[model samples]
Each structure stands twice: as structure tokens, then as C-alpha cells.
Target: MKIVFALLWLLRLLPMWLIGALAWLLGSLAYALARERRRVGLINLRLCFPDMSLAERKLLIRRNFQHMIRLALEYGVCWWSSAERIRKLVTVKNLHYVTDLRAKGEDVILFYPHFVAFEMGAYRMNQDIPLVSVYSHQKNRELDAQIYKGRQRYDNCYIVSRQESLRSIIKAMRQDHAPFLYLPDQDFGPRDSLFVKFFDTDAATIPGLSRIAKLAKAHVVPVIARRVGNRFELEYYPPWENYPTDDVEADTRRMNAFLEERIREIPDQYFWLHKRFKTRPAGQPRFY
Candidate 1:
């Protein structure tokens, strides 16, 4: 299996159409076999986009799988793609925002929701800035090494484990030169998390983002990367008001609210298969 993956990675160097076609075929096969996850994916889509008719939601679901496949293949190329090559693929709209923040001696805490080509955003930023992002290593140790290697391609980009970096992130935030990129939408352990409303449902969101921002006095900048025509378009959203309260819970809620609104803007770009609302509501029956 490891050798097979290596061969697949080597093959990814071919034309994107070949890579995308193979990825779509593989993703389709996985979806067909993954009965439980597919059902959960559909359920998640229906809940999040209740206004969409069944047909519309189903169509979106199909397209979502194709996007996922493309992401899977793109992983191999993310690290190797040169700045010039990458720029050709993504047209960044708000270059001035990032430059302006750095010019003012202010480090940014970029919030990336699970959007189309989300991982690529991290790789691209690492080329231009000091970016440290957190990630959970895969359960398979061998695969985890490969994935981690790919993610840590850039000299300035560090991939810190969730456990080890919890305190370090806060420390780094205080430094004048440290800027962090984070994906704040995943489950944090019960003790480390707060339940917040996302897409009108109670979801578990890591309070780390808010706490780190408040502790480090960093500004939260929301961003989404989506496919435009044949390439990607990255839009840098305006920064949110600084952590208004010392209260971590209140801060978490506000940050989540920002992400929720951003996700709604390009709904299909968000990752729907994830059980974002898995953590049960207070006094509510558990679903999973």
C-alpha cells in the first residue's frame, strides 16, 4: 500500500486532467464503498442547507465528492509547486490587506474554514509569510510521516501537533514577528472546547483560537479559497474586531459566528462530511 501511494504521488506530476480524472475515479470508488460516511455526508448537507431542494442538495453532494478528489490529488503537488506556478493557479484579491497588517507591526491570526483547496492556502501563505499551522497526524504512522513531510515543505511554515503547540501558540502570538494560520472548526477535547452555534446547530469549536487571540492580542482574519473558472481564487476578508471581552467563551462564539457567515457565502466549498455538530448540545440526547 505504501509503495502504491508513492507511485500515485509520482504519477500526480502528469497533466492535471490525468490526476483529476484518476482522483475522481478513486474518490467515486471510495464513496461507493463508504456507505456510512456517504449517508452522514448527505445528512450533513441536508441539515446545513435546508432551503435547498432534495435534488439540488444531492447535486451539490456529487460535486462535493469531485472537489474532494481533486484535493486529494493536489496534495502531492502542493509542496513542489513554485511560487510562479502557484500564482498561475490562484489569483489573490486582497494582497494589500496582508501587506498592510505586516507593515504595521501587527501579526495576523488567519482563520481558514474547510473550503475548497483549503490546504493549498496554507502552502501558498507559507511561501510569503511566517506561517505555523496545527494538524492532527493520521492514525496510520507511515502515512502520517508522508503527510507531515508534505505539509512542512516551506522553511518558515511549521506543522505543530495539537497537543504540543497548545501553549506554544499562545507564546508565539505574543512575539512581534510570529503569525499563525489555523483551522478552528474541528473538535477540541471536551475540556479544551466550547459549544457554539454553527449553521444554526450546536457544534464543538476549539476555544484555543479565541484564547490565543486574546492572550496574544492578535487580529482574526477570515479567508476562503475557492475554485474560479479552472483555477483558485483566494479572497482575504476584513479582520474582525479584536477580542472585545476577556471572556473566552464569548470570544469563541463571535469567532465562530464570523466563520459561519463566511461558510454560507460559498456553501459548497465547506467540508460537509465532517460531523461539525457531533458534540451534543447541553441537556440534549446524543446522536452519534
Candidate 2:
């Protein structure tokens, strides 16, 4: 693991175009060799886009693997690169959605999904404003420490452990006025999760976005990041109005619907390697 991190640090010194070419070659090799991951990606695509042909789905999975590798190679850029270099690599759009709220001394929840360039977007956003987000500890202590250091490289950023209670996260947001970078798209098992329609299939999704928003009295601002060739684009949509209504299930469904629309816009950029449908409802067959 130490050697891998050292190699990534060295790779960061290479030109962007060269890094991209390397990503392309390595990504293709990974897609060909990583059978289990490729199978999971295909299963996800088949479940989400049943209307598409097998060849089309396979092509999307191939591109998704390439994007995933590209993101992995850019970890050094996110972890150790200069802020000016990151600013040059990522372009922010409609940033006032969060900034304007912060200016008014209001709490904000950045509704970020599991996009391939998510870390890049978060790093770029952290450059301009402080952020509070959840952190799950990695099993490897060295890897966990490296990720912790990378995430807190900037000043005023707060990372609450996943084991902590909701009150702790809310307190971090209220006290620091940092926008909570919330990622509520993945399946975290059945506990505290509802079977919501992710696309054509039902997915186990947590309603934490709505719950946290209501608890913290924060506005929800949906954000997405995409890789455009070698650079990245971070877009911030307008804040939601009348969110966290009486029905938690409705709010969770609405979140999935919004995610579906964005995934449709850039199908390949969305993360598909994970076993998203791993935890099926009672009596349903396994997806992976």
C-alpha cells in the first residue's frame, strides 16, 4: 500500500494527457482482466437499462471502467496537488447555490451522488468553502490515515466518522457553517433504508438526506461532477424548495428520481462497479 501511494505521487508529476493515455491503457486492461468487477458492472447496467441492447450496455460498462481508472489515477491530484492546479483542472458552475446560502448564514447539504469524479469535485469545492462530510474507516490503518490526511488537507474541513450519531454531524454543520457533503445514493443494507426505485428496479436507499436536512434545518443543493476529456466540471443545481416533507419515503423516492435523470444525462460516468443491488428485498434473487 505504501508503494502504491508512492507510485501515485510520482504519477501526479506527469502531464495530464499522458496520465489520460495511461488510464486508457490500464482501464482497458482492467476491464479485460477484472472479471468479477466487469460482471457486477454489467449486472448493474442490465438492471438499470433493460431497454438497451447487450452490446450497448457492454460499451457503457467499458467506458465506466475507463472513467473509474481515470479517477483512481487522479487520486494524487486530489490528495497532494496544489490548489491552483486543481482549480485549473475543475470548473465550477452555479456555485452560488451553496455560497449564497452560506452568505445568509444558512446550513446547506450538498446532495452529491456516486459519480466517478466525485472526489475531484469535492476537492475543488473545498478550495472555496469549508465542507463537512461522513467518513468510513478503511480496514487498512495506513490507507485510512492517508485518506484522512488527504480529505483534511484544506483548512476548516470536518470529517465525522460514520460510527458517530446524526447529532454530531449536525453539530459540525451548525457550528462551522460548512456545507454537509452528503452522498445518499448507495445501498447500505436494509436497516434504515427503504426500497426505492433507482431506475426500473427497486434499490435499498437510505432516507438520511431528508432526515439530516430536517434535523439540521439545512437546504439541499444537488451537485454533480463529470469528466470532460482530461478536465472535470462541477455543477451545482438550485436548492430544493419545501424539502423533507411529512413523508420520508416520498422524499427518498424524489431523491432517486432526481439521480435517475442525472444518470441518464451521463450514463457512463455514474459508478456501476459496486454491487448496488446486492441487498434485495425479501424473497428476491441476488443481483450479483
Candidate 3:
């Protein structure tokens, strides 16, 4: 079984388009056969977009499946593609926004949600400015090893484990790094997270960003990478310059709400497969 898995991993390193086609086929098959996830996807969509009719919800669900597959393929291709080739695929804007923050001696925390070209955006950012990034480790040891190799391809990238505390991320910023890039949308277990309202449903959100930003005096910036005209647009939203909130939970909730707004704008670009509303408050059933 391990041998077969390793062989498939090797195939993932093939030319970009070939791997993309394979992932599309695999995703379509999964969407067709995985009744449980498909139902969950549809349910999640309905809850998020209550105004949409049945046909509209179904269309989004199908597109979401294909988007998931394309994203899987993009991961393999982005890691293997050269700088020149990768540049052609993503168009970046607001570079000065990040640079200006760094110039002011402000260590920034870039919050990115799970998007189709997320991995590619991570890679491209490191090429421009080395960042200390935190990545979730895969269960498969072999797959994790390969992923680490791909992440380290550029000059300014570093990975930290979840076991590491907020101080570690602060230290990375103190080293004059670009940004401490991370996604806070996933479930962070029991003690590591708090329930925050995302898209009208309570979702687990990591408070690490708020704590670390307060401790290090770093600025929190929302960054998103979405498909635009067959390429990508990596945009950096300026920090809330006039922010008045000192409360960690309130600030984090506001940041997460901003992410939810972006997701609504481009529903198919976000990762719907993740059980976003996995941990619900008492009396509330799991939404996905």
C-alpha cells in the first residue's frame, strides 16, 4: 500500500497540466462516489447561501468539487514549477503595502484563508520576501516529507508545528522576516481555540494571531489570493490603521468576519471541504 502511494506521489510531480487533469478526474470520481461529503458540501452551501435556490446551490456544490480537485493539482504543480513559469500564473498587487509595513519596523501577521491557489501564493510571497509560515502536517509521513521539500524551494520560507506556541511566531517576526503567515479557520482542538461567528455559524478560530500581535506589537493584515483572468491576484489589505479594540477575541472575530466576506464574494474559490462549523456551541448542531 505504501509503495502504491509513493508511486502516485511520483506521478504528482509530472508536468503541471497532466497532474491537473489527473486531479480533476480524481476529484470528479470522489464527488460522484463520496455520498457523505457531497451531502455535507450541499448542506454547508445551503446554510451559507440561504437565499440561493436549489439549482443554484447544486451548481455551486459541483463547482466546489472541481475547484477542490484543481487546488490539489495546483499544489503539486506550484512546488515543481520554476520561478518564471509560476510568475506567469499569478499576478501580484499591493506589494508596496507589505514593504511599507516592514519599513516602519512593523512585523506583520498575514492572515490568509484556504483558497484554490493558496500554496502557490505562499511560495510566491517567500520569493519576494522570506516569511515564517506555519503549515499543518499531513498524517502520512512520506507525504509530509515531500511537502516540506516543496515548501523549502524558495529562500524566505520556514515552517513551524502547531505544538509551538505564539512566542515562537513572535520570535520569527523579530528576526526581520516578512510576515508570520497562517490560516486560522481550521479547528484548533479544545483549549487552543474559541468559537467565533463565521458566515453566521460558529466556527473554531485560533486566537494565536491576536495574542502574538499584541505581544510583538505586530500588525495583522488580511491577504487573499484568488483566480483572476486565468492567473492569480495576491492582494494585501492594509492593516486597520484606526483600530480601537484592545480585546483579543473581538479583534480576531472582526478579522475572521472580513475573511468570511471575501469567501462569500468568491464562494467557489474557498475550501468548502473543511468542516468549518465542526465545533458548535451547545444546542447548535454541526452545520457541515
Among these predicted structures, which one has the highest TM-score? 2
How far in Å is the alpha carbon of 104 misplaced in model 1?
A: 2.3
Clashes of each: 0, 0, 1
Pairs with backbone N, CA or C atoms under 3 Å apart (clashes), candidate 3: 130-156
What lDDT is reached at residue 283 by model 1?
88
Please list all clashing residue pairs in model 1, or write none if there are none: none
Per-model TM values vs. the true structure = 0.89, 0.98, 0.89
By summed lDDT, the worst window of 10 consecutive residues in model 1 runs over 170-179
**Residue 227 lDDT in candidate 3:** 69
- Candidate 3 lDDT over 1-288, as tens digits, reads 457445455764676566656666787788888788888777777767788898887777777787777676566456666787677777888877789988888788888888877877877777788788776798988778878888888756767776787777777777875588878777766566888777766777887777777777777777898866346778888786634257877877887788878988898778776666677777876665
Off by over 4 Å in 3: 1-25
Q: lDDT of candidate 2 vs native?
A: 0.92
| C-alpha local distance difference test of each model | 0.71, 0.92, 0.75
Between candidates 1 and 2, the one scoring higher on lDDT is 2
Cα misplacement distance, residue 12 of candidate 1 (Å): 2.8
